[model samples]
Target: MKSKLNLGLLLVAFVCVLACGPKKENNETETADTTAVSNEPKEFGEADGKKVSLYTLKNSHGVEAHITNYGGIITSLMVPDKTGKLEDVVLGYDNLADYQKDSPYFGALIGRYGNRIAKGKFTLDGEEYTLAVNNGVNTLHGGKKGFDKVVWDAEKITTDEGEGLKLNYVSPDMEEGYPGELKVEVTYVLTDDNSLKIDYTATTDKKTIVNLTNHSYFNLTGGVKGDILGHEVMINADKFVPIDSTLIPEGQLESVDGTPFDFREPTAIGARIGEDNQQLTYGGGYDHCWVLNADGEGMTKAASVYEPKSGRLMEIFTTEPGLQFYSGNFLDGSLTGKGGVAYKYRWGIALETEHYPDSPNQPDFPSVELNPGETYHTSTTYKFSTK
Candidate 1:
């Protein structure tokens, strides 16, 4: 009887071990030496007669992000809240066709020139070039068929930094009225430290201009939540570019001192957003670019956001010289996003890191010109946490 009991006890113990043992095999490579690529990639949709794919990128932490090769867009980003509950923070549509349709940039990658160029025209090397006038008189986000509207070649990548996807696209000479055959590669990595890192690289055969950035509208409390005006925002910028009637920079920087543009201190986005100010009136809200005050360059902290209710915090660090803090002023009630939620005005906010808008036209600004021999490289990381 005692021998039989011992055998039964051993069997029960073995069952428990099988059920509760560590799940390390799924996330095996925790160190730098091994490749830890996440599995499970699916076909997203077809675009321009090509099959697009969505890749799942997971860190050792519970964080996961879904990115599709079409436009190199992030379909969803799941991160943990203060209570250890994972939730999607970035805003987008549930359908792939909606993304390819009338939606805003959402989680798409912006490029060639991320922000606006003055009057859809610029004189590069004393040669004037004309581009598609999409946004009023200026060219916004690369033009009508910008980098955000095309397909990219994506491959699973695992570096010492983290596991993610490497998306490559080659822009033919003057594809969007921009010169040079631009070969570009962008890598999206979700590190174990609860951060999403974006590495951008490009090389041009001829002299061309480039300012690449990701346009992910974030709402820390989740996309389906209400307006983000209650969220606290702090940007390390002492100066901001003022806009004109058409939302193009006037080629000047104004001190943020004593103005609503001052985000030097953590303040509610709506605290002074409605102030009777000229800049606010011109932008219809906070839509202009702010010159960031970084400590001697090379990926310094640019901005940080905190959602009081969810206790979610996101910190932005980048090598770019300027940050565009848009308050989603144009998100009217005309469309619905993920989970059938209407995206109203001020529903999301974008903290886009890049060179100053119209950098090619503003000679005083940091040059966006990429010559044949020069390589264009920049990176930005968004770190998340909970208080």
Candidate 2:
């Protein structure tokens, strides 16, 4: 009977081991799933008394985008290079405090009128409205507190193509001197094809001007250790909007032919950036808007950048009419970015797709007026590939 009892005890122990072994296997599978595609958001910090979270979105191709809802900012984007090695292709801070303290927009979303309005003044419906002037002599990027500064409500979504983060924010009437109760929804999707697609939709209760865009500073080299001067750029634009000394558009579109602004062909950013051009001097570098050539009205190829060393290529497609290519001219090594790297001049570049700058003030430009019954919608995609 004692032998029989020992046999039964051994069987029970074996059963327990079998049970625990599957649990470990299950845990391993869960970890693999999380690494492949995860929607779980970790607490980033508190912003404006509200809890902020950081979301990790990974695609089938292992492209990961870490986005925080504080400013709907993409803190880091890991993309694969020519060697199938992944690296962060965007510039941003490692922590929330750094971003909140000071940021050059980084990977945040811009809204309520991107670029600038001349002198922060725009007359809508015969009523002159004055906005908070942040840039010199103009209201830039939605003025003092643009969408980049506000916290947005975020929701994890599963798109048919890949993972998505849907962000929503409401701008009250007369907020930032804008005349509207604007409700904005922006969705960011990381596709399996290695594309970061942004979809924007907004509606307002009152007539207000609206222009939204993402301001992600990109360095195809995968980090801020080097500058983007060697990257070849090709903008599908025949005309470009020349800016004044204040960096506001001159309200007239000029042909890029025979000018340094000509990027109809693949050209290095530093090739003509130092040419004796007044526009270059005014903006300190290439901070002008290019008039994108359209082939219908839907999304068209706006611009492309290729880094030969890494064999990384990024193609921009947008439904907007204009594309602002701003070389990182403002960075002066005053701020330290990810990995304790100092952000220097021309370390990164911004390719912002939107309507023309100061659109509300420029009647000749595209109208940015959003009526109560009309809906504002735009989409931009930055597709990445290797040579």
Candidate 3:
């Protein structure tokens, strides 16, 4: 009888062990499967009369970036630091509705004319042309409907430069009343060296003004939590184009000396933003154009920004003559961003590579006229690295 009791107790202990361990393991397995299912990507909408899909590019070091064919916008850029934590370094929206309706031109390709046109009028080779006036008494960013909204004809291309994707769009004559059928092609090339090269090309059927640029708001602090107040910025410029109260250029190239426009050395963006300066008040922040110190030859370094916290650094190289350093002053707490984060004022920073603002109206400014038999070509690159 004692032997029988000993065997029964042993069996009960075995059963207890199974009940305690395997059952807990089953629960853990179920919870892990639930988490795995939740992390899968959800389906999104279509674009451009084709199978609009999102493409993800990853480097050998596991840095990933997502690009969608819709407007050729960059959805997100994930970079892994020395600690093996990946972060979305660029600002973007969550769904298609936010991007379609109230986008702040985030990660978009702005073209035809990147900035504004005074009075919606300009004289090209002594011929007057009137463009679409969408802003108050002026035209901003190509018009009410610009290239940023249109889905470009895209193609994945390979180049010795790097793995690249090319997008094409044809702006028909009088589409927005600029006077030319412009065929434009923009190439976003990702290099193995962590640089995003944007090359633009265009040809017009008639005489038209053209200036293209990319609007990518960057927050090197992983696009979360930290303001850019601590980031150091420098622009290779000695003179800047100041604007009036309407944020339109007043046809004068002002010196950066003794002004907040000077960025020869690294300075915080908010250092001179609140100063009692006329240009600051007119811009509501730093929205003016800086005449880049280029040799009038090829692509050169225009600007550089370094975020000490994340150790992510961005260098802007472009063939354009000017750069627009926008502090995102108008980004009020109205637009909900990715993961329902409210993008408050100055949430991101835009370093627009283009000609000066209102260059079409300013006679002394660089010519933006694109006529027949002449191709409009411009290139800008944003190279990223961690210090």
Best by lDDT: 2
Question: What is the C-alpha local distance difference test score of each model?
Answer: 0.90, 0.93, 0.83
Error of 2 at 19 (Å): 5.6
- How does each model score on TM-score? 0.90, 0.95, 0.86
Q: What is the lDDT of residue 359 in candidate 1?
A: 85
Q: For model 2, what is the alpha-carbon lDDT of residue 203?
A: 98
Give the poorly placed runs of model 1, Cα more than 4 Å off.
Answer: 1-38
Q: Candidate 2: worst 10 consecutive residues by lDDT?
A: 34-43
lDDT of 1 by residue, 239-291 (tens): 99988888888888999999999999999999999999988998889998999
TM-score order of candidates, best first?
2, 1, 3
Estimate the overall C-alpha local distance difference test score of candidate 2. 0.93
lDDT by residue (tens digit), candidate 2, 311-357: 89999999999999999999999989999999899999999999999
Better of 2 and 3 by lDDT: 2
Instruction: Using TM-score, give the best candidate's number.
Output: 2
The clash count for each model shown is 0, 0, 0
Give the Å error, residue 111, model 1: 1.3
Q: What is the TM-score of candidate 1? A: 0.90
Residue 380's lDDT within candidate 3 is 91
